[model samples]
Target: MPNTESLNVAVVGTGYVGLGTAVMLAYLGHHVTGIDIDERKIEMLRRGELPIYEPGLADLLHASESRLTWTSDYAAAIPEADVIIVCVGTPPLPNGHPNLRYIAEAARSVAQNLNGKFQVIVNKSTVPVGTGDWVTRILEDNAPDYHANRYAVVSNPEFLREGTALHDSLYPDRIVLGSASQEGIERLRQLYRRLLEQDFTPPEGVPRPAGLARPQFVTTSLNSAEMIKYAANAFLALKISFANEIAGLCERVDADIEEVVHGIGHDQRIGHRFLVAGAGWGGSCFAKDTAALISTGAEYDYDMPILQAAVDVNRHQRQLVVSKLQRHLHRLQGKRVAVLGLAFKPNTDDLRDAPAHDCITRLMELGAQVVVHDPVAMEQARREWSHLSYQEASSAYDAVRGADAVILMTEWQEYHDLDWEQAVASMRRRLVIDTRNVLRQLPSDTVLEQIGRRRVQETHALPMLPVGASSVHV
Candidate 1:
């Protein structure tokens, strides 16, 4: 087990990634200090308010308030930390490469603030393969003195999903660390000893480790570790887009994607995850990381044709959803549309490259009045898309009230059990677009058409169209 009695961890960048790591480490009995540039954000943290939406995160923060400290003081955080984890965002550039300015800046600060003993600087952010070497060089360049052995750099990329980030962090499927030096590897092993040891079970009744010898600690080289994150995300992104592409094929052949996904997911070769056929993958990780991987391929004079196609398909999938909406209604013009969810996927309030953004923007461009309802994404959506005219509704039915059509964009749990009768009654026209393929059952065809209602099933749908498609009644 980790000697958690007196370990100080400084987490730079207090966004979702940073906050998640800091709070989790604190929960694991480490003295964690979160450093960010935003004073207002720091104040919010001080008040126990988390800016982002991640289930079990706020409660984790509250539970570990005594062990976790929030601050904007870079100097103080760095000097006091024995292990500095860089959990900052590495946003994609216009040319589809990761912008490493934040990573470099954080590394420089950590290097400049070096004080007592040797520290392990863990790169918990998804970065390019050579980033470990780059961070090492950057830190060495900015060191207080030329003490080469003062600090060690290790790449320990995070693999937390936005919605269940807390759970993923605390009980990760695998913890990968890449380091050149023995000391750096040992330090990370010590920091993650609890998880490595697998002392705690995965919550109550949450399925124990399957066919595994407890939880083995996997350590690898820095390049492999960095490559692992990109490769993993890229493959998952490919799977999502691949499933979506298959979903389109299924729709064309009148095959139910749900049944197909269920069948395919049962195959041991294709484990069930990221296979939901809907508006393609989104949020901070998949897009940026895939693009970064492609960029890396470009730099090496190699091509990632399959990954490139996956990215293309994901982008095109958003447009496909918009066309499906337009088809459900004859035209989006003069239509009052309700978008039920905004976040990329459910259980989180992250709207980065969300399909809802594309769907809403396209609908508005075609002259539709859009009202949106999400259990937790309203505030973030308001901030991110202030210019879009949308009435925030308390419930899904409220959002669908007086709407020509309602589009289920993100598949939130509340949208799962929608009151079909109320929804049909509230809508001026009963045209529904089920993009996520989440509709379980509907009223009989006669009852639905009698109510002038039609449900647009997202199956074998064509790509990039100008509306006008066949719809199923009920």
Candidate 2:
């Protein structure tokens, strides 16, 4: 068995998952080498600069700098690693299945550098269920001289949110390890013993959660571990979609959704975590994982109607922003529509499958001049959305000034503390579509539209669409 006191850990990939894992492991007293093919990212990490925006990550990274190393060469790191963690991105393909090209490449590279030392290969990426077996096969095929006893493959999926990744890593709800080999599981258990036992000093700004003395260390078959990740994300997405669906019905029935959710949330079984109604659930995890789960079921000839409907409802939620705009402006043609928020959520600059992207695209298609702003994602938005025709505002107020209508897509604290009275005074048409229902202390006369909440102006008639705009839908 390898020494658990201070193991040599090689974490592949420097994306959100990989970087967070490396930093956390380093803080836990492991000598971690973070390997990635991206030279620029590795160079940045070497200079103590973060490539991504995650709360408390940079501080934790700095604190763990002594035990951390960054490099682009896998051969330099993998051979000496007692634990090799594959945290590469498995982005979803057009057909809703995750493209495992990165996983395969990482596996092949790890296999080729075995160095006759027994190592445990851990899959921390969210991938398809059978990937553990596939990775094991690849390792066996690549390392001809080494026997099967030389290495073991394990599935250790991560459950992390972007903004709170450090906190999640330091004090996760549980630590799950799945492998056929008991030895592989035991190695990981020892590696995570400090976290599992809550024995380490809590990092500054990321204190241990209340009543969380120790987190469960769950172990299961490899397939079950992989499915656990997908199922957990899909269920969370479903909860958000369910809340949105009920929010729609609440509006139709003239009942307030906030009161309804609050009333039901009081029940012990249904706590009020993901029950808030909003523009929709948008992030890297929910949509991709839910789609992948549905695709997995289809491969086995199993139908997943609930998961499909969740996706359909989320897509329709984005379109509701445009529909609300049309209701106020009567037409989108030549209108100055300000989209307040570019990132999928508050706190991070991730725009993968963001609702704002869909809304802006539909608005542009309908001839509206879209001006967008996010607290931190503007640079990233410019990089990713340069081809799209839209103006980037320097601030939220800049985006809203003289705009015909404002759509609050993200609930940033800055947006919440916005000068609503002044914002309404500057707007040519004093209408604000609060998609997140988070805008507070609004001017009573200013037109405020919200999802699942009664509108400021109750109009039952549908507004007329602009010419050629009827074809545009999110």
Best by lDDT: 2
Per-candidate TM equals 0.90, 0.95
Q: Which stretches of candidate 1 lie over 4 Å from their true place?
A: 1-5, 200-213, 445-474
Instruction: Output the TM-score of candidate 2.
Output: 0.95
Over 1-474, each residue of candidate 1 has an lDDT whose tens digit, in order, gives: 134354899999998889988987787778999999999999999999988888778777887799888889888789878899998888999988998999998898888898858899999898888899999998878878746677888888788888878767766778888988789888877778776666654443233456545345668989999999999999999999988888777766756677777888999999788877777888888889899988888998999999999999898888886676655565778878888899988999999988899888888888988889999988898889997877788888788777777788887878878767556555666566777766656533211110011323233332322232222435
Among all windows of ten consecutive residues in candidate 2, which has the lowest summed lDDT? 465-474
User: What is the clash count of model 2?
Assistant: 0
The per-residue C-alpha lDDT of model 2 at residue 210 equals 79
Off by over 4 Å in 2: 1-4, 456-474
